[model samples]
Target chain A: MSARRGKLWSRTVFLLILVTVAGVVLLPILYFLTISFASNYEAYQFPAKILPTFSYPARLRYNADTENYTLLLKKGADFEAVKTTSDASDFSLYCKSQLNVLISPPAVQTLFDRAKASDQAVPIKLRKDFFRNYVVFFILAEGTMRALFNSLKAAGWTILISLVLGGVTGYILARYKFRFSTTFSTSLLVVRMFPAVALSLPLVVYIMRMNLYDTPFALAIVYSVPNIALTAWITSSIFKGISVELEEAAMVFGATRLKTLRTITLPLAFPAIVASSLYAFLAAWNDSITALIMTNDNPTLALLVYRTVGSSTIPNLPAAGAVVLLIPSLVFTFIIKNYINQLWGKVAL
Target chain B: MSYLKLSSLKKTYPNGVTAVKDIDLEIEKGEFVVLLGPSGCGKTTTLRMLAGLEEVTEGSIVLDGKDITHLPPRQRDISMIFQSYAVWPHMTVAENIAYPLKLRKMDKRAIASKVEEVAKICKIVDYLDRYPAQLSGGQRQRVAVARALAVNSKLSLMDEPLSNLDAKLRVSVRTFLKEIHRNTGATTIFVTHDQAEAMALADRIVVMNEGRVEQVGSTREIYNECGSLFTAQFMGTPPANIQKVALASSRGRLVAAAGGGEGAMPLDLGDRSAFPGMEGLIGNEVFLAVRPENIAIGEPDGVNEASIEIVEPQGAYTILVTRVLGGEWKIMLEGDVDFRIGQKVSLKIDPGKVMFYDAQSTKRISLS
Candidate 1:
C-alpha cells in the first residue's frame, strides 16, 4: 500500500478500537445514571427505558353514557385508573401522585369542571418531580446522608494510613536491599488475597472487645489492610523508576537524606502517590463486604446502598444511593486520571 | 598533604562484588582530574565514593585536612552533577539552584542573589522561573551544572555529564564546562569513558581498568608514554598496533624477529639503550607497541616492510592500514597523504616512541 493510504487505514483502525473500548466501559455507568434519575413509576416500567421522563403522559376518559370521567395516571407500580363523577374534588390526589403538581381545591375543581363539559376525554399532561428520588435518597432517607459522611471519613483515614505506612514500605522496598526484603514484599501481596470475610469475622470479635465495632474507624482499619499492600506495590514500582541519583544530588548539595526525600524524591514521585491514594480512597468508599461484617449501628454509604438492594422492592431509591456512593469515587478518580497515566510509563525522576 | 587525598580507598558490595579496588590518589587544590576508563572499570564507582553516594568499604578520604570517609553526603561539603542531569522537575530553575543555600539556613535575599549569579554564569538566567520539563535536554544539563556551581562547594564531581548530548552539543558543552571550571576553580573530579573527552578537559587523566587504576599522569604522558599495555591500547583512537617479537641472530647480529612462523622477518632493534638487564633473554618473546603517528612512511627502506591494504582519509590526517606479523598496523600521515591500495610500504617506527611490554605480564618495560 502507499504510505498515505496505509497511514489512513491504521488511523481508522485505531479510532474504531478506541471507540469500542470507551463504549464498553461507559455504557454501564450511563445506564446506572439513568436509573438513578428515574422515579418510582419509571423504575418499575417493564422493558426499561434508557432515559427518564420529567412529566407523565395521561388522558381523562369521559364516558358520555355515565357522565363520569376516569383519570388514568401512572403511580408507584404502573398506570392506575381512577373513575369518579364531575363533582369529585380528588383531582389533586392524582396531581400529587403523577405530576407532583400542587393545586388548590378551587383549581382542582376547575380542572374537573373542564373535563365534565367536554364529551371527549380531555388530553391533559402532568408534570412529574425531576429530582424527587435524589431528594429522598439524600435528604429523606434516615441514615443515607450520615452514611455518606461515614464513607468519606473512612476513605479519608484509609488514604492517610495507606500513604504514610505504605509509602514508607514502598520506599524501603525500592531503595534498600535488606535481608527478607523479597520475602516481606511477596507476603504483603499474598496477604491481600486472603478472604476478607474470614479475616473480618475473626477480627470483629477483637473490634467489639475494644468497643470499636459499628464505627467508621473500625471499618477503615479493615479496609486499609489490602489497600496498603496494593499501594505499596504500585508506589514501589514507581519509586524504583525514579533515579536514585536525584536523591544523591540533593544530599550532595547539603541536604540530609530525609530532607532530600522530602524535597526531591517525594515530589518526583507525587504522581504515583496521588494515584495510589485514589486507589485507597475507592477501596474504602466502595467497600460493602467488609462494611457488612464490621459495622452495624454506623454502616458506610456503600453498605447502606447494598442493604437497600434487599430491603427496597423498587430500584429507584437504591439506585439513587448507589449514585451517591459512586460520586466521590468518580470525582476523585477523575482528578487523578492524569496521574494514573504515569502508571504504564517509567515515572520520570 | 594535597587538598584532597584518597588513601587505600576501596568498595566491596554486600553481594561480594568488588567495584573499586584499593585506590590512593592525592589531588591538589584547583586541579581538574578525570577518571577515564571503559565500562566496568570502576571510574564511576570511585567518583561516587568521593561524592559520598557510595560507602567506602575500607580506608579513608581526607579533604582539606579532615577525614570524611564515613560522613554523609550532606556533611561532606561536596556537590555532584549526575550523568542523567538530575534537575528536580518539581522546582523551577531558580529554586533548584537556590535549594542548597536554603538548606544551609541562608536568608532569602542572599539565596536569590546567589541563584542569579550562578544562572548568569551558566547562561540560564532567562529560564529561572521555568521548570525542568519546560527546558530542553541541553538546557536541563546547564541547569544541573548551574545548581552544582551555585553552592560554591569545596569540590565538584561530575559523572559523564555531557555524554547525553549530541556530538556537536557535547563539544560546545565541554568548552562551557571547562570555562566554568576556570572561573570557579573548584577542585573537580570528573568520570568519563571517552578518552578524547579526558584528553580535552582533564589536567591529569587517571585511567582505570578492571576495577584498578592503570596509570595517573598528564594527558600528554598518558597518550605519549603509556605505562602499561592496557593504557597503550586504550588511549589512542586508531589504537597502537602490537605484535609479539623476539631478539634473535640473523647474521651474527642482534635483531628483533617476528615470532610468526610463516616467512619470519628480521626487524631492527632500533637502539640497545632500552635493554638494561635483557642481554641473556634476547631470544625470549616481547610485545612491541607503536602509535600510528610514530610510524614514518615513504619508501620501502625502513626496518619493517608491509603491504598497504587500505587508506582512510580522516580530514586532518590519512590513515594507512597494513598487515604486520599477520596483524593490522595503522600508520597515520598528516594532511591527505595518499597511499595507493595493495602496495608495499616500508614503515620505520621512531625508536624513542616505541614501547616494549613484558610478553607475559603485559607491564611496560621502562628503560633503567
Candidate 2:
C-alpha cells in the first residue's frame, strides 16, 4: 500500500512536469498559429485570442410603438447600432460598412421584417472568412513562392555538401591515428564556435567576385561552413562507437579501402548521416542573417518573413509566412528525431 | 618451403610500446595454427600483422613465395573473422556473404550460387535474407564465417572468434570452425587466450608471453614437455604447480627439499633416473614443476606429505588444494575421495612428468 501510494505521488509529479514542459514549448507556437490564421482586423486587436473565431454576434430590436427595427452588431466591447430601418431595403450597405459582412438586400429585408413583427429582440450572426490570411500570404503576397523555393534549394545544397565533406572528415578522424589527429579533430570543433553570420559577411565579397552572389548555391556554401563542422562532430562520435573491426573485416574480405568504406562503414553510420543532414537542413532553412547578407535578388522565405517584421504593421501576413516556413523544418526535424532514436537505441555492432 | 613465413616480424607502436617482439614462425599449407597467450601478450597483434591490418615495424611476411608484409589487406587475399563477429548489420546475410564475391566482379548468378554454397556450409542458409541484427549471436558468428568462406582467400585469420559466445555455444562453434577448416583445408591462424581451445583446434600452438614467443609445438608436446616455465605454468586447467626447491642427495639418493615460507618440509622424490645427467647437480637449487593431475593421494610412505587445506568436488574429479612445500599445492583426485581439511596425506609425484627449470633463467632445464 505504501509503495503504491509512493508510485502515485511520483506519477503525479511526473505528469505535472510533463504538462509544464509541453505548455512551455507549445504556447508560443499555438499563439503564432493563431496569428497566422487571424483576419487583418483581428491581427490589429490588442491582446490576441488563442483561437480564431469565425462569426460575430448580432441583434435586431423592434420598437413596439413605432413598429421600426434597429440592427446592432457586436464589435470589441459594446453593441454597435447600424442605421435605423423603417424600410428593410437599407440594411445591405450599412451592414457591409459597419460589420465588413456582405448581405444581400433581400436577406436584410427579410431579417428586418421578422424583427418588426417580433416584440422581443431577434438574434442573428455574421460569418467571416477563415483562410483569408493564408491566401494573402501565399498567393497574394508578391514573390513569397519564389522565396520558398530558394529556401528549399539552399537547404538541399547545404545537406549535400555538409554530408559529403563532413562525413569523410568524420570517418578519417574516427578511424585513423596520427600525430595531429587529436589536434585536427579539436580544431574542427573550434571552428564551429565562430559565428556563421560573421563568416557570411566576409564571404559575400567572394560570392560577388565569383558572380554567384544572388544564387541559392552561394548561400548554401556560407551555411555549410558551420554546418560541416557540426556534422563532423556528430558523425565522428557515432562512427567511433561502431567498431573498427567491421571495416577491417570488409578489407580482409577482398574489399579495397574505398569499397570497405562504402559498403561497411557508411551504411552502418547512416542514422548519424541523416541526423547530421537534418542539422544542415535546419541551418540553411532557418538562417536569416546569413541569407540576408549573402543574397539580394534570391531571398529565402525565412529572410522575406524576417523582412516583414519591419515593413508590415500587422503581424498576420508575416506570421502566416513563418507558418509556411515551419512545415519543411518540422518534417525534417521529426525524421531526424527518429534517426537519433535509432542511432543510440540499438546495438548494431 | 613453408606456405607462410614471418622472419623477424616485429611490431613497435608510435608511442614506443612493442606489441609483438621478434616473432619468427613458419606455418605449413592447410595447417591450423593457434596463437595462444594471455591478455596483452600480443597474440592478436601477430595475427593482425599477418592479415595486413597492423603494419610491421621490422621483418617481412612471405606468403606462398610472395612478400605481402607491406601490401594492403585486400591485396593480400586474406579473410579474417573478428572477435566481435563484425558481420555487416546493414546487409542481409546473403548480401554480407556476397559483397566480397561481388567486389571480385563476379556475375550475379555466380555470386548467388557461391553465397548459397557458403551459407549452407555455415548453416545460415535460411537466415540469408535476414539482417545481422535479426540473427542470434552464434548465428551471427556463422554468418561471419560464411562471409569469410565466400572469398576462398589464400589465408584465413581468426582473432579470438569464440571469445564472445557462451560456454555451450563456444564449444559448439569451436567444433563448427574446426569442421569448416577440415573441409576447406584453408591455411588458418587462430588467436585465443584459451589453452583448451588451442588444444582443441590447433595443429600447432604458439604460446606467447610479454610480446615474445615462449614455445610453439603440438598439443601433446605442449602438455607433456612444456619448453619453458611460462608454458608449464600457463597451459593447464588448474595450472601446473611451480615452486622453488632445493635438490640434494641424502644417503646416496637425490631428494627434493621445499624452500619457502610456511609448510617447509623435505621430500624424497625417488632417484633421478629420468633426468640422466642431473646427478652432478644434486646440490643445485632449481624450479620444480608438476601437473596437478599427476600428483596422487597415497598412504604415508615418506615421499612428500601435506595436510588437506580444501576439498572441491567437480563431479568427474575432486580437486584437493593442500598445504605442501610451504605453499598451497593443487592435487586432482579422480573420484569421490573421503577427505577432510587439516587431514595429513602423502603425495607421490610422477617422475616422468616432473619438469625442472633453471634457477636463474626460468627456462626449462633439459637434463636429457
Candidate 3:
C-alpha cells in the first residue's frame, strides 16, 4: 500500500511539474487572447475578471412609472448616456456609424417605442460599434495577408536563384580540388556570417537610386545573396559525404560524364538541395530589418509586424496580424517534418 | 597475333611517385596473364593503365591494332572488375548486367535476351532482379564478372577480384574464372597479390616488385630456373634455404672441401678452364642454393652431422629445422620423421641438385 501510494505521489508530482512549465510558456499568449475578447467596461473593472464565467448582459433602469429594465437602442439613431453604474464612469455614449446591423422587426419596434414614448430618454445601444475594432482589424489583416504573399513570393524566387547557382557551386566545391578550393569555400562562409542589417543602409540607398525599391524583385535579389552563401556551404558538406566511386562506376558502364552525373551524383545530392532550399526560404521569410529599410510603400509581413508598434497606441490590428503570420510557416514545417531527417541525413531530434 | 599489347607503358604521379616503370606486356588471343606481386608493386597500376583507367606517363596501349592509350575508359572497348567488385549498389543484377547494352541504345528485346544470357552464364539467373546488397559476397563477385562479360570486350582486366572472398570461395571462384577463360577465349589480364592464385590460373606469371619486373615466366620455369636470388627466395612456401660452403680446387678441377675424408663424393664443378680465377680461391666461400625437398635423413656414410632444432609434422610431410652449415635450415622430408628436438641427425645434400653462386655478387655460377 505504501509503495502504491508513493507511485501515485510521484506521478502527481510529474504532472504538476509539466503543468507549471506549460503555464509559464503559454501565459502571455493566453493573456493576449483574453484581452481580445474582453469588453472595455469589463477591462476597466476593479479586480478585473479577464475570463467570463457567466453571461453578463448590460442592464439599464427605466423611469419610475415603468419597472421594466431593458436595453435601450434605436434604429438609424444616436444617443448619449449619463449615469453612475459600476466603479468606472457610467456615461458611456454610443453612436451608430456607417455599419449595417441586422435586427428583428419586433426587437426594432421595442427599441423604437421605448425611446419615443418615455419622457425620460432611454440610452441607445449600438451593436456595430462594439465590433468596429474587428472591422479595422480585418482590413489591416488583409494588408498583412498581401504583405505575407509578397514575402513568400520573394522567398520563393530567392530559393530558385540560390538553389540553381548554389547547387552547382556546391557540387564542384565538394568533389573537385583546385588551387583555391579551401579558400573559396571559407570565403562563402564569410559572406554568410556578414550581418544583413549592416548592409541594409547602403542597400536601401542603392535600391532607391536604381528605382528598384518597393518591389518583390528587389527584395528577392537582396535576399538571394545571403541565401546563396548559406545554401552553398550547407549543401557542399552534404554532397561531400557521398562516395565518388558510384559516379565512376556509372561512367565505366558506358555512361557519358553528364549522364553519369544525372543518373548517380544528382540523385544522391537531391536531399541536400532540398534542405538548402528550406534554409534559403526560412532566411528570406524571417528577415525584417532589410525589408524594413529597403521599402516604404510595400512592406513584408515581418516589416508589417514591426510597424504595428505605435508611440501611444498599441495597434491590436497588427498584433492579430502577427498571429496570422505564424500560421503558414508552421504549416509548412509540419508538412515537411518527415523529410527533415532525410534532408539532413540524420535524425535532428 | 596478340589480342592486346602494352608496349613500354609507364605511369608517374605528380607527387614524383613512379608507379609503373616501362612495363611491356602482351596478351595472346586466349592466354591468361597474371601480374603477381606484393602490395604497391605496380601490378594494379599496370592493369589500370591497360584498361585506360590510369593515365599512362609514356608508351602506347594497343588493343587489336589501334592505339588506345589516350582513350577514355568508356571508349577503350574493355571491361574491368575492381577489387571491391564496383557493382552498382542501387541497380538490380539484370539492370547492372544490361547497363552497357542500354548505353548503346539497344532494343528492349535485345537487352532482355542479352541480360538473360549473361545471367545464365554467370549462374545467377534466379537472382536477376535482386540488388547487390541482398546477395552473398561470392554472388556479388559473380555478378560483377557477369557485368563485365555483358560488355563483350576482347579483354577482361580483373584487379584482385577474388581477394574479398573467403578461402574456399576464392578457390572455387578461381576455378570458375579459369574455366570461363577457357570457354570464352577472352584475353584476360589478372592482377593478384596471392602467389597461389597466380600459380594456379596464370599461363604466364609476371612477378613484380618495387615497380619493376622481377621475373616473368610459367610457374614451372620460375620455380625450376629462377635466375635471380630474389626469385628463388620469393617463390616457394618454405623458400629455398641458402648457405655458404667452401670447396677445394686443385689444378683447376674443383672437388669437395678438404675436411671431407677419402670416401667423400666428389663434386664435378665442370670445366675449370672457364673459371680462370679459381687458382687463389681454394679457401674462398661459395654460396650453395638447395631446395628444402632435396635434403634427406640417412646413415653416416653420405651424411653430415646436424642437430635438429624443431620438427613440425604436417599431414603428408614433415618439416625439420636443423642446424646445417653453421645455421638453421628448414628441411622438407616425405612422411613423418619422428625426430625429436635436440637430436643429432645426419643430413645429405644431393650434389647434382645443388646450385652454386658467386659469393660476392650473389649470381649463379657454372656447376654443370
What TM-score fits each model?
A: 0.89, 0.87, 0.73
Q: Write the per-residue lDDT of candidate 3 for residues A193-302, one digit (tens) a residue.
A: 77888766767778878898888768877888877887888778877876665666667677888998787677666667777777877777878888887877778887
Error of 3 at A61 (Å): 12
Arrange candidates by DockQ, descending: 2, 1, 3
Pairs in clash, predicted candidate 1: none
> When only chain A is evaluated, what TM-score does every model earn?
0.87, 0.84, 0.66
Off by over 4 Å in 3: A1-138, A141-149, A160-188, A199-239, A295-299, A305-349, B242-304, B310-328, B332-339, B347-368
Worst 10 residues of 1 chain A by lDDT: A340-349
Return the clash pairs for model 2, or none: none
- Quote the lDDT for B336 in model 3: 74
Q: Candidate 1 vs candidate 2: which has greater TM-score?
A: 1
For candidate 2, give the docking quality class from DockQ. acceptable
Ranking by TM-score: 1, 2, 3
Q: Which lDDT tens digits does candidate 2 get at residues A151-253? A: 9999999999999999988987887788899888889888778887779888888999999999999999998988888888889998998898888888888
Tens digits of per-residue lDDT, candidate 3, B1-368, equal 56787788888988899998887777777788999888998998998877766789999888998888998778877787878887766577888888888897889999999889888889999999887777889998999989888888877889899999999999999999998888887888999988889999989989887887878899987676666666666777687877666767656555544232334344334346645555665666776667889787765443366678988999799999976645568899998768878877677665555666667876666534
Residues A3-43, model 1: lDDT tens digits: 99999999999999999999999877787877877766566
Residues B142-190 of candidate 2: C-alpha lDDT, one tens digit per residue: 9999988888989999999999999999999999999999999999999
